[model samples]
Target chain A: MTRPDPESRRNPPGAHLGAGGSAYAFLFFPMAILTVFVLAPTIIGLGLSFFEWKGGPLWTGAGGWNLPTFVGLQHYRSLLSDPDIRHGLINTIAFVVGSVPISVLVAFVLAVAVNSPWFRGKALVRTLLFMPTIVSIVAVGFVWRWVLNDSAGILNWFLSLLGYNDPPNWLADGYWPLFWIVVVQIWRQIGFCLVLYLAALQAVSPSLYEAAAIDGATRLGSVRHITWPMVAPMTAFLMVTGVISALQVFDLVFIMTGENETRYTTVLNLEIFREFSYGSFGYAAAIGVLIFVITIAATALQLAAFGTRHPKAAGRAAK
Target chain B: MSREHRRRAANTFNRPPFAVRLASHIVVYTVAATMLIPFLWMVLTSLKTSGEANTPPSLSNLLPATPQWSNYATAWNVGGHVSLLDFYINSFMVAAITTVLAVAHNALAGFAFSKMRFRGKAPLFWATLLTMMLPAQVFFIFAYVLCSWIGYIDNIQALVVPFLASGFGVFYMRQAVTAVPDDLIDAGRVDGMHSFDIFWTIVRPIVWPGITALAIFTFMNSWNSFFWPLLVVDSMKMKTLPLAVADLASAAYFTDYPTTMAAATLLVLPLVILFFFMQRAFTQGIAMTGLKE
Candidate 1:
């Protein structure tokens, strides 16, 4: 019996010996699923934005469901005129603009403090800080709802003890609902940003800080000169991702406000849900398309502002 | 300010001022404590009787006079039409199946992207990466329509199927797979192992850490998924834990604080425990997903 060479055995007559062909075989399932679930729906959403679906699916008594009626640019025009959606857009922007900077700054401070050499039990502190991020957002919203209740909430209780007789209704009051929602969002998200900043901070070479100190720089000076510049890319990354997630914020606001109080906390996503529930599928798709466009534009802006290359690894060698 | 200067400076200035260190400690611990307040309150409120939970604002109201352990039972049994156990089963089934499928499919695709040469590989990978930038809400309207057309509305498949492939998972796994040395793959090929066989035996084991990270992430995200499940599932029988919790907190039962807290506690405790054991993996997974190269 002649032993076949390894290459011949690997590349048998019908086998996919070429790497490119084998890659196709490996990629077929995931690509198919992505196309159907993500890509196809995105395109369908764009198309649906032009057509009006006034009611739930009508069975045509034939084989299939009826298509929505076509009304080009009407939903888009209506979106511009709708006060609720206009407020929703403002609320969404308010959330992103309000939460991102506060969360990032607090997280940066926490990261710097926790990353200090003298900080004991750093792991424990980090874990405690990050605990909120792991909990379900709906649960967090509910818990916060109770905590922010005017009469019964512990926060109010504490405030009352501090000599304030009337504590504002954090979740129910005008504008306060949105304010508390942003606060809860920042609370939940700060840990994630802190962890990322910590990683980036640790990746910064100690010699840079040491060198700055030797040059008669203060701790704050060294942090400003060395640490901040080194972590700028991570900051840029966080800002972009943060703003995107914040723009799409739904769960916390929805669960906290319970789909009512549209005047206070209706975000763009909640508006989409409302439109969909009302069988305004076309309008919802239009809003969805708007969100997609804004997300892409924001991402493009970040890439333009920060450049594509991350300075993470490069910052280490500069020391 | 060079290395020699730094050595001298470090020897002379080895320690920071005590006040500054104390300030750092105070700042870190204060934030940590504030971060922990909600969790602490949840656990405490879960132990409170309904009356105590609803009591007027006072210092003593913060703690239950008598811990009502039965709140858990009530929350699990009588608080909702669907039993909490059923919700757990549904949640676990959806999350478990979704995690398995996501990890497996993502790992296979990541391996292809990293190890195998392919035409359009660059463009295809960038397309998939671009999908990560597209928020899930962008797909919500049409995903709902698609599910309705397919008759999956009010069905668990609506929750599980759309999420079976994650772009973030693929991106993270591809990064992990790229770190696997080429020599190892060549050696596996030399042994006449097929690509799938090589992936199962070699690549999978080498990237188990990444797989573990992705699995935890997928499970957590699926288990905590609120928006899509809310949109798709309307039947009480099909409600995931998050949806059920939301329902429990809504108008009909929002005033029932103990039962709601108990439900919240039940919803949170598992992930908390999971995070406890897998703390490093959990944090690393978040960093990996967010701070990709």
Candidate 2:
């Protein structure tokens, strides 16, 4: 309902003095956001990593943490040694490895399918396909949970219809927990990648494809020679964002897995949440710090590849 | 450019050529249908009563056996004590405030980066780019503790304040601002106007479209954010739509699937409406990113 501002007041303050002050004011809001949401928790997490408390600010120091004791790296040792944590870590990796490539592949196929002029109703199909992305992941999790419900659920009904006598416990079973979770994750994330790929595919210069056709090239030849290099940057961007987003994956896992504290889907962040819930603030902080460290290292490698110098060198190598 | 290439490619899929066209259409439609069934299922289930929902397997389950439209009213009423309407209000407020503030900050930052220069600008921009890769969860555990220390924990500020700064928004707006001509600002400068005047008079009006598109996405994000909100929001009073509806879904054990589906439908209404109204902006917003245009 808000109208566009009248010309008089709608204008930015270009003539205003003290660019630094205005800049500071501008920087203030965004920086404050990052400070509160990101930096502060990170600092507090470091302090908490060293101390042990049971559900409170009052540090008993019983765990040998400095608040009263010294439990140097004891939490880390326990976390490492615990088979559950080890299993959860493995599960998290299995999820990342399983979902990321497949989602990317599906997205690419969908993009190509919709991108080609050979098909009618591409608009309807693309919207329908991308529709899942906008739906709440939490909602999607619950819906899929119903679909996968072990008893009286649609999945089992369909499987039995297909002649399998028994459909395993979708949520409770240890076996396909990773599989179902990955399926939902891929479903939710595929839409974003599809949009990205579609954009990237369109950005590809058509003249190159035409030139390739003139050279007696096949569709595969055009994709290999022209399409691949053009969209490589977009692919690179998706990978970097995809990996980071994957490592931080929580909403679907949290909702799908539910309040079973001992569930196998717990990742590093979940471990931190669990530790905090258990009143071992220090240990939780350490786990968070460990996650941050690994993330930083991973992101650095990703950015380094995206850096012009490295890629240029690689391009030189290819030639 | 070459009829021969088209003909040669046609040979692989079809010796007759007309069959490939039909085959492609079949493949595309099949993929589309696979993608749409979940949404189709959600709406169909919403109209059914709790009793019908508890019943297993029936594509025959399409229409409610006994339609209970009252489920919408109850779902709205039962939503984690916050209720659907209230959650919508709270969500709208947070998203609105976040969008307004983020747009203002990014517009200013983008203008400065594009037009004004002091020192270390590229480095500062690069630093912001690097921050984009930060996994938010890595820092949130600490952020929670820090918020608690500052008495911001469980406060709506915890819900809203931290989301206003977005590096990608700034980056995108900066690109848009750069497309604004330097000569336009120069003409204003010759009129004895200052830099701020130039930004207000020339740049902002021109860049408002970009600002608007960014706002929609930002609003969508704020409306749907769960993880951090989950961390801070405990009271029913502060619950957002996703949190409230999710609570309904989680607790409904032998309860009616119809009611849960109704609840889910209501939850998504605001987004669907917003997207429908501004769909042109959203699509144009994405299409702009293709870069070749």
> Which candidate should be chosen as best, given lDDT against the real structure?
1
lDDT of 2 by residue, B9-128 (tens): 533332325675677677767766656666666776777776676677666764677767888887888855456888878788888898898888878778877776545667767756
Tell me the DockQ of each model, to 2 decimals: 0.49, 0.32
Model 1, A183-268: lDDT tens digits are: 98899888989999988886776667666666787777666667777888889889988887888888888888866856668889
User: What does DockQ come to for candidate 2?
Assistant: 0.32
- For residues A109-219, could you state the per-residue lDDT of candidate 2 as single tens digits? 667666775556766666666667666777777777777777646677778779996777888877566688899888776766777788788666555555555566777
Judge candidate 2 against the unseen true structure and give its global Cα lDDT, from 0 to 1.
0.69
Candidate 1 residue spans exceeding 4 A from truth: A1-21, A54-59, A62-65, A307-319, B1-14, B79-81, B251-254, B291-293
In candidate 2, stretches whose alpha carbon ends up further than 4 angstroms from where it belongs are: A1-20, A43-48, A51-72, A160-165, A261-263, A296-319, B1-16, B79-82, B119-127, B283-293
The residue pairs found clashing in candidate 1 are none
TM-score of each: 0.92, 0.85
